[model samples]
Target: MATEVLFYHLTSQPLEAVLPGLLMKCLERDWTVVVQCGSRERVEALDAHLWAFSDDSFLPHGTAADDHPEHQPVYLTDGPDNPNGAVIRFLVDRAVPGSIEGYARIVLLFDGQDPEALAEARGHWKSLKAQGAEVTYWQQKPNGGWERKA
Candidate 1:
């Protein structure tokens, strides 16, 4: 089975601003999510952001170090382990998973302002395409919305 890969180019907003909404969408679909980031610092920062991203909103999530990983609707980790049994996986800040096929959907969010991040995303896109994955590229619009470019 080919995995559906989505590349989100972040320009108008930071990951903290956009991630909660995306995770919320997944939750709406009743799909558990695993968010993998580049470093422990990034993971911790995201965990904090998800809790305080909005005054009126809150995303129930926890780090790998937190207790009861299987109970978390959204799991955050620096490694590529899926203890939460998530069907959707989010790769942000250059965190590459060991295999994309295991997940139903894979979202790669990269910072557009960083040349290194852009190049890495491009490489991942080409690799996944070559591997016969269904891939889509979404560019962030000026209004902080996403537009599918490819």
Candidate 2:
């Protein structure tokens, strides 16, 4: 099956703030998630952030150091492996997977303020669209909401 690609252009908030909400939505629908970052440091940063992002609640996630990845509802990694059997994957920090297969959906969030991230996201958009994938683009509105642009 073809993977649906979603481009989330972040202009108002950082990934640390936006990620958990999306992950929560996925969990609400009973969909597991794999969050892929570009480096180990980013993975660690996100790991820490996710744990403390909210004071009211927390998302259930794990990393390689946590062990037993197969049991985690959300898996954070710098690599491409989906140990948690997640049907959906979120790519951040300019991380690109080796293959888009084995995923029902792929969400790519980029910093609208960073030129590098913006360029990389556009590249992925063009590449994936040319390959006949269903791609959509969404930009953040002023109130921290999303509006589909494509």
Candidate 3:
């Protein structure tokens, strides 16, 4: 069973300070990482920078199966309407039988600044738990650096 690691970040502010080490850990274990974020350009920028160490990192944009071959990070969008809803749906959709295989783990990276995004993330966390997927979340503090509170 493949592990589904869901990283849901509200923005890409602290990803540079946080994700590199975590990403390395996943790569070492051959775990697939799905970084769902609101900023596509920032996420891609992070992806381009992180490839210095490994090239297996990716973000799902559609039905693509780990489609990114380069070191660039895959980009997912969270537009205006139901921003958080889109993320929850993506994770749920991926967890369906045969949709994703192997050990499944999801890492949700979110920002604490946005009240709306936070509330939506918390609610969606419950939905994620109900779906039988292990979820972990991290938020970047105002001073910088990632803090895992849940």
lDDT of 2 by residue, 24-102 (tens): 9999999999999999999999999888888899889999999799999999999989999999999999898557777
Return the lDDT, model 1, position 83.
Answer: 89
Better of 1 and 3 by lDDT: 1
Per-residue lDDT of 1-150 in model 3, one digit per residue for the tens? Answer: 433445455444544556566555655664444444455555455545655534675432321223442332322333222221222222211122222233345455555566865676777666656666666665555555556666
Question: How many clashing pairs per prediction, in order?
Answer: 0, 0, 17
List TM-score per model, in order. Answer: 0.97, 0.96, 0.50
Query: After superposing candidate 1, which stretches have Cα over 4 Å from the reference?
Result: none
Sort the predicted structures by lDDT, highest score first.
1, 2, 3
lDDT of each: 0.92, 0.92, 0.45
lDDT of 3: 0.45
Lowest-sum lDDT 10-residue window in model 1: 95-104
TM-score of model number 1: 0.97
